[model samples]
Target: MQISRLPRFIRYASALALAVLALFAAMRPAAAAPAHKTEGELSYSSHSGLTNSADGSTGTASTGFQVLLPDGTTRDVNTFGEAIAIAGEHRGSTITLFEPVTLSYTVTVPDGTTINLNSQGGVTYAAISGSSEPPLRVESGSTVAIVNTGATQVARVQNPNGVFAIENKGTLLLGSFVQVLVASGGTAVYGNAPQPAPGAFIVDAPGSSRVSAVQVVQPENQTAAYSGSEGETVVDLLAYVATADSGVTVPVFQLRDKPAEDPTTPSGAPDNEWVLATGPGGATVSDADELVTGDYTFTLRPQGATGDYYGYTVTLTVSVTMPQTVDELRETYRQKLAHALAAYAEADYLADDWANIEAAYQQAFDAINAATEETAMQEAVAGFQTAANLVPTAAERLAAEQQRLLAELDQAYAAYDKADYTAEGWAEITAAYEQGRQGIASATSIADAQAAQQAAVSAMAAVAQKPADPGTKPDTIPATGDPAAIAALMGLGGSAMLAVGVVARKRG
Candidate 1:
């Protein structure tokens, strides 16, 4: 029994020793890994015309925004303008403030119709109980839009929803910022009218801006002007009656809520949505996504050639969504890349296309950080490097992307050089080049992409040193240093050797 136990102990001790060695190996920082992993910021967005099929109470059409955050192994819908978590390939991971933001939405609820806390932006945080969630916000101003779009021709205002006084809509005070302006599309028809594809309109407010709701439109009286200064707290509702398609004359805005102000006769104020619209001048209310965030007042008034006449009213309920996620970011990136590349491809294409150059490279990096599969990361890297090299000039190549890739290459090459730029050195460079190549498919044209792929294959062939027939030497050998240029030259030979360790370590 003692002898048998002794053998078992020795085996156990040996196993422990192997584990320590493996751990030490693991701790050595992944050989030539890039200094900074941008996996969290990379993404691939496709506008499948799929429109976010998922419905929300907000009623806005969907934006085909999908994202692959860093450290995450899966892909998901980047809803509510929230940034995808960047740390892992798993869902619900976070990348902090690093995610690029691109969201613009506006929601207009009809007058007398009340919208609640469910319409504010940055809905990604912990919930809070309150008498007021203060969700409504108007971007760049003090007044909010009160757009009326209801089946009955009017979404009436629920009186006294959340009242606050304001100067003109533009003063944009410090605490409560409320300003009234005509929304580009009053109704924001998500399912009906046009404009925003599916999501709501988003507003951008730097800080400390406030928009109030249901403020009175003061007469020419001193109190009729500003809110902070002894001015009357009023609703600034600018109304434009579509006199024609290319032109619209500002109409009369009826004054409401002044104690002395009479409802029967117009007091030179704007039109309040007192009665349902039944004529050609009727308003249409559409759904918009995340608008600005804060308190707001929406006033509607019709205008005409004879000064401002009494028009109808419309109240809008707006929603503010924040952290605009990677989908929007991808859209922005795609557009910029296309524009930049188009410019770079000109016969006299001399510009570096730096903006897109960085974005494309970053996209590749982000893909790697977010993807869990080693294959995915390697492919993403390869594609990225390919795109990075296509920008047509060395000036463009001197950018951050180049610096980063070069740095990583330097480290990898250094490792190889340490091993004597031998077969292993060539193998490592080959891997780096392959990783960079994989990132190009989605980033460039098919013709250009195929060219890159062919180039890569030829490179592999050269590295492996094959003959016309596996048994005989080729007519020509690949040149040295240009591992990817071709394999027909006498360059360091090794492709199979490089991919072996990666496959064993990651795929296995």
Candidate 2:
């Protein structure tokens, strides 16, 4: 009876221990799981024309902007902030815009990344945060149109650090409604606008005939008179209203002779009637014959119907001198050509690139020498300047060559197999690689560095392969053993040795 009671106690004790272990597990906190890294591409596409019929949806599907992740998955994003958040999570990702859209909110691009706007892509009516290391790049062939609507300015690029923040290589269309402020170290490579000042911006269109603020010389008093030469282009008198409180239409103005009393109508005969002209930024006088030596009063208003005047009006006097002489035009061309040649000499191009530069200079020289008109000589000088700007400097060429050599050396080292070659051959390959590495590190010229890299590659190709080992046997055998048995044992031993050799070769 005592023994039976002892077994029951032991069973009760085991149950109590199991209960205690369960309680401890329930009270302890669980370990946290590791976070997943967000990587790869995140693309944004606005389904511009897709309908519900294509998606087989019962109701109207939301045709807003959708983001495609790297894992071949996509989700609809409602705001620009959502898209930016998704893009920021993916390290070193590219944001591709598929359709034209206006973002009302501010876009802060991540560091060391690019936002590519395709042919049909554009962004306007938004503020882009400035960056120096990772610039706000406007790709070629894309048109980024900035237009003001009422009191709101089109776009504002803020760079307080005074670094180059905007890199515009494409077309930037600026309407006459507002001044798109791009302050502090903004670069425009392919536009007609002038270089940006420290606090002011440049409005540039590569092929458009619009006159920007850079071309206009505005005095302190609005009623002041401006003078120009007789041969000056009519665009010189055009005025661009730089304000942010108007619509998208260009300014329209009427030019007429200054009146004596009223100042609205011409003081002379009826033949001196008002000449009407219109343009996107300012009025363009197509015929130069209309511009005579006279004081003109022009009234500027926003382009609209007959009775609507959305913008302000301006009246000014313009005086033109007699047409320039032929000798004066020739002297002007000579001065411009001299300046262009000086600039060409200052551009420190690579040694090999000098041939192209010389050829361009010779062509410019011949064209200017034979040119009879001022326009032809100016064109030749402009062409030469453009050619000179395209050549890379000596330092830039050397850096590129060094990068190429380093990449090739890395590939060679990754593909090398040490076990396939003999010990002596592997040593030779290692020495060659070290020599190439040292040469690249201390190289001052492109040619010497390339030679060193080539030598290492050649040495790697000449590496010798290891020879297979042949098995051997003892000369004497025991006389007491059977001849057949001895022969079988020897054959088995040889087979085993060969198998070991094969295994060793594979392991190597």
Candidate 3:
């Protein structure tokens, strides 16, 4: 009984020790590590016919235009000039600023229109005004400027909405949440908490350097934001209305509140969806796959004319449907390969050239046969098409080969006439020659001509090794018109070897 009690006491002591060690481990703090970040500088440029479509309906500087509506619908603007004159038909009509287009006249935004200023180009918002009811929202980028100075109640700042300003001689009434980059000589009137808030009023000495910024954010816990002298911030309040393309109109943009930027953190890629289109038409757009199945919008600006440098606009909405099914795609590829193969087979394939080509075709065909899925089969078909186009036209190949065979026949006859042979040997030689000549005359292809050429070479060989006449002396051979010529022909040279077949016989 005492021994059992001792064992229980030892177990309790071990458990208590383990609990003390766990508590000590929990008291230690973890080592902290600093986070790393990266940022990219904003770049700006402008170009013409930036985007166009296939089939030629819309093009850069081309006659027709298209307006993208809010509901993913498009309005065709018959001419570039017509598109610029009429305000858009829809209430939430929106237009994207693709390039800098100088306005011939002042443009006004009706009650509820928004403009999206893309980040890729420097745009000048010259002589522009928004209706007092629902003010225009502009999404700014690297280079964008608003120049307006005539009205009252003209600007109001809605935090997280947009920056606003009212006009004075050199004095301007700025909103509460404003991001400003005071350029050289640009001055601002601070609005204090007890009085008005700071950075609420800014004045641009009429002839001072214009201010520029990528973005500015409202400070935390402050009634009014500060007016810092640093002008490196990039602002983004993009807005535009073009009179060309039959009054292209866009909805008022919903500008976001300026946010604080940590110096240590890196910036990211621009939030703009604009893409540069190189060629005239055949514009394709998809977020991930080739067959897009939902509604999407693509904006295109025709490359500005080379000499005039005036850019054009085309905005369109497309609803992509699922293309072919796997089986359907397989069938299409099969048909295409079949057609190519048929065309190639009808062509004349030179024996030397066809050797490699035939091997390549067979490889592709084998791949197709081994394919277990649609993609693999499609790849095989592509390989086959590439090989098939290399074959030459049948007529051209046949003519070239026929001429070659004709030359060989002439050489064979010449060699035959010079050879010394008995009457029986001559008869055998003549029969084979006539057979080859007929084969050549009637041949319609390279293969047939090749066969004919081979037969002629055999006739020359038979004439060369004809047995001596039975009555003639064994050492006395028939007279060869030219012994030297006969010896040269027998020692086949150049293309002569092409005609001769290998046989184990000595020359007489």
TM-score of each candidate structure, all chains considered together: 0.17, 0.30, 0.24
Question: Model 3, stretches more than 4 Å misplaced?
Answer: 1-324, 335-372, 379-407, 410-508
Q: Write the per-residue lDDT of candidate 1 for residues 1-508, one digit (tens) a residue.
A: 4545678879788789999999999888656856864334323343222222232333232332233343434333343232222212233332111111222222221122111111222212111111222222322322222221111111121112132111122222111111222122221111111111111121222231221122223322111111121221211111212112213222233222221123223445443332112211233322221222222233334443443332234443212122324554444444544444454433332344665566776787577556555556557656766786666553333343444443543354343332324566467557745654563333234344445545544444344321234576545543455444355332434666667778898976
Candidate 3 positional error at 220, Å: 30
Error of 2 at 412 (Å): 4.8
As for lDDT, the candidate ahead, 1 or 2, is: 2
The prediction achieving the highest TM-score against the true structure is 2
Against the hidden true structure, what lDDT does model 2 obtain?
0.49
lDDT, candidate 2, 173-209, per-residue tens: 4332223333444432224332332212344454432
lDDT of 3 by residue, 373-476 (tens): 77898788777767666556667777877888888787767665424566777777777877887888789877888988897777657454554455854353
- Model 1 stretches with alpha carbons more than 4 Å out: 1-271, 274-309, 312-336, 349-508
Which candidate comes out best when scored by lDDT?
2
When superposed on Cα atoms, how far off is each prediction in RMSD? 32.9, 26.7, 28.5
Off by over 4 Å in 2: 1-322, 345-347, 403-415, 422-431, 434-438, 458-467, 472-508
Which 10 successive residues of model 3 have the least lDDT summed? 232-241
Q: Which candidate order results from sorting by lDDT in descending order?
A: 2, 3, 1
> Global lDDT of each model?
0.33, 0.49, 0.41
